[model samples]
Target chain A: MLGYTLRRILQMIPVLLGATFIIYALTFLMPGDPIAALTGERPLPEATVAQIRQAYHLDDPFFVQYGNYILGVFRGDFGIDFFGRPVLDLILERLPVTFALAVTAWGLKLVIGLVIGVYGGLRAGKAADHFALVFTVLFMGIPGFVIALGGQTYFGVHLGWVDPAGIRAGWPMAFILPALVMALEAAAGLARLTRTSLVDVLRAEYLRTAKAKGLSPQRIIWGHALRNAMIPVVTYLGLSLAGMLGGAVIIEAIFNLPGIGGLMVASINNKEGTVVVGIATLLVLVYLVFNLLVDLTYGLIDPRVRI
Target chain B: MTQLLEVRDLRVQFSTAQGTATAINGVNLSLEHGQSLGILGESGSGKSVTARTIMGLLDMPPAKINGGEILLEGEDLLTATAKRRRQLTGPVMSMVFQDALSALNPVHPVGRQIGELYRVHRGYSRKAAKAAAIEMMDRVRIPAAASRVNDYPHQFSGGMRQRIVIAMALALDPQLLIADEPTTALDVTVQAQILELLKEQQAENNMGLILITHDISVVREVTDQVAVMYAGRIVEQGPTAHVLGDPRHPYTLGLSQSVANEDLKGRRLPAIEGSPPDLLALPRGCSFANRCPLADEQCSSSAPPLESVGAGRTSACFHSGKVASNVAYSN
Candidate 1:
């Protein structure tokens, strides 16, 4: 198991390199000079523009600029943005808001998905199972942004149940709508996956053995079937963490929240290459770490996976 | 000895897309305290279904107990409430299934799997359950029971896993243990060991046993009486020695002929011709009439009821006396 984990960690190096290369290459291929964009529509002396380009390594070849950026990253320097602010500090300041939204959404999805899934799986082909199946399918079919908008109008404007937009001192209530909207689609998929996987596991021979052992229905489901069924669910949950981070961009934009995803999008529109690439690198790191944790969890949930 | 389990005219049917298949039809079985009954049959002969129905493990929508009575210690299991059945399962009777690896929960440790019986039914504390698990493991002859108890199902070898399954089944000392093809998934040497362990345990506990297997030698070695089942019905049943030595029903005669005999080592072993009858559309007369060499107009036109032969034997064949004499002369 340790060997497998170490090997997986080593495998992440190329994925990280590829991610950094893509982000760097994308900025390089962008039309017009970043320094010119930085200078905006105001006219400047040719020497001043050239000096600005040279200082930012914008005057160098693509490979040279990319190499220099990679070196800066290794040295913990994400470089300065258009406003002369350190991109790392900018990302750090915005990290908490994004983490709060994504983590809460992930938590909501996990809990709700698992509950619906287990209920549906245990009572398969019954009314509860049918309801859960149809509910998840409907949630999955609708887009997340639509839900966010609809929720804001219904829960915030019409019902006055929540603020619907913006973080307040009592942020938990403020986060509810956005977080729930963020969770809906993923939770629906998870609920379906959980239901199917649990149904399959419940049909396994060991559950019959558990029943023959005179275990209560609760013990058989929770103690025996649920543990084995959660293996695939854990993998999905880990992958969903990466997905939630990426998904937060549109959700944050829709809700007008100041999370990293929103920051990345704003930077992209402004062609602030440093901030965009810096945030992209952080996301890539998060993706790699979560995948590694998922692999480790496989061993924890199923002993056979350790080999 | 008092009867421990009495199954009278048990009929089980499954509603499939094809049709309503009668898996077990008009099966009558009874076991006394400390007696072992080996139910021998080929694949798809309803051996496992019978065991599952007896344990109340079959799901009702697909599988229905069309008609029957399963009386455990004079209490009808069919009418028993779900809670009452659950209460009776672990302490009153339990079953060991085929395929030990799949039979034991893959996620739990062996000790925990065995200990769960006591924890759920008896409400044993974790410490006490663990101790009892070790003791059961020791009884099943799993080496280093104290240390190995913590190991998961995958950690143990197949035979050891099967032993763990048996240990779990008999942990609460249930009055009856129904092992459904328990050794079918084991190596020959390991099969012998498991059978021996089961026999010893049954003897020690004075519990009734139902050993279901396709292997004739296994049945002969472990059971006092044998019932030959073909297409959901018992073709013949009697003391093991008497039945195997001189089979009455043509189906049982054919089955005994299929077994490898040292006296006929030089020649090809005989096999029962034709496959088992289709369960979805069984013959109105006798299920095995198509395959029985002695089958005639009477055999094909009407099903023969189980009739008494001499010496506490029963055979469901019109020509039981003739077939037994023919088999005797041939031997």
Candidate 2:
């Protein structure tokens, strides 16, 4: 099992490299120069432009630039942006903000989704199952941006329960609305996945055996059914967490939050390519780490899962 | 001996898209203390349904027990509270499934799964149950029971898994052990070993055994009496020695013929002509008329009740005596 996971971890390197390489390549496709965007329309001398270009290595081949970026990522050295701010340092600072939001949202999503999903699944073919279906559908149907906006509009802006632009202060109460919006959207899909998985698990012969042995429905679900059902849910959660970056972008945009996703957007808009690339690389690493954590979580759940 | 279980006129039905499906119709049987009764039937003959109804495990809406009196030691099991019935499942009665490999929780340890009855019913502490589970595993003759107790269901072989299920069933020493094809999942060699273990356990516990299966040889090996079910009802029932040695119902006779014994090898095996009647679209009266050789206009219009035919035997047939009365049905 150790060997298998070691091989799996080793295999992750190229996949991540390839993904980042493609993303970086796509960034090069975007029009306009970072230095020009930073220091607009003021015509600089060709030599001064060359000096700026050389510093950022615009003269280097795309492959050579990619190689240098990969090496810099390895050494934890993301160079300065056009604004002359340390790209790595800024990203490291902003990362905790995103981490806090994502973690809260993830926690909410997992707890609510699992509880409601397993509940609906156990009460399958009943009113509860129907209700869960409708509820999840309603939540999932709306776009994340819309949910975030509605949350900010009603809960944050009018009622004054929380701030509309999210917490400049790292307070827990500020987390409630944005985290809830993210959670609501995530929970819809996660709940559906959990419900379907749990429903299948409930129908498994082992569950029937448990029932026939006279276990109460609650005991059966919590004891026997939930553990097995959560396997698929775990897989979905891993993928969802990997995709969490994309969601964060929209969420950060909505709440005007300072997170990796928020930083990504700001850097892109301000032509801060180094910070953007650095954040993208970090996102890839987080995705890889999240996947590994999920693997280990699954191993913990099922002892048959060695190591 | 005192009666442990009495199932009378138990009719189970389902109102499907294809009309009403009579999964089990007017099936009657009984078990006395420490005695064994085996029900043999092909698939779809409602053997498992009868067992499920007894356990009250059938999901509502689709499955409804239209009429029945499932008396366990003179108390009506059908009318018993769900809680009471559930209470009795582990304490007074228990069932072992056909596919032992699938019948257990795959993720949990086999010992813990088996020990749940003790934990749930007897209030055995986790540590105590763990120890008891290892002991139970040892009783079932599982090798290295103590160490292997933590192993998952997939870790064990099919026969060993069946033994584990048996261990679970026997853990509480329930009065009745309803083994639904207990050895069906096992090989022939393992099958024999399981049968021996079951018989030994049943005798020691003085538990009434209801071994449900399609194989005549398996029933004959483990059970004292045999009931032959056809088209959701019992056509004949009596002592296994006489019923299997000399079957009364044509279905039972046909079943006995197909047993591939030395005496029947050369004989052109008389297979049942058609599949068991579509329970949803069952004909007006006797469900077996289409396949029964002795069927007439009267036989087609009316279903026969189980009437006393001979010494210790009952056959549900219009012409029970006119046929092979020499085929004795005695225990």
Q: Specify the highest-lDDT model's number.
A: 1
- The regions of model 1 sitting more than 4 angstroms off are A1-7, B325-331
Candidate 1 yields a Cα-based lDDT of 0.89
lDDT of 1 by residue, B189-290 (tens): 999999999999999999999999999889999999888898899889989888988888887777778777788788777877789988999998888888
Chain A superposition TM-score per model: 0.95, 0.94
Where is the poorest 10-residue window by lDDT in model 2 chain A?
Answer: A166-175
Instruction: Go through the candidates in order and give each one's DockQ.
Output: 0.84, 0.74
lDDT of 1 by residue, A193-307 (tens): 8999999998999999999998888888889899899989999999899878888888888877888978998888788888899999999989999988888878889888876
Candidate 2 per-residue lDDT, tens place, B207-250, comes to 89999999888898888998998879999999999988877776
Write model 2 residue lDDT over A1-307, tens digit each, in one string. 7787788799888988998898788777667787778777697888999998998898899999989988887787877777678888898887777777887888889888887897888788899999999999999999888888887889777998788886664657777678888999899989998989988887799888998778877788789988899888888888787676657777877887888787888778877767777888778788887888788677777777757
lDDT of each: 0.89, 0.84
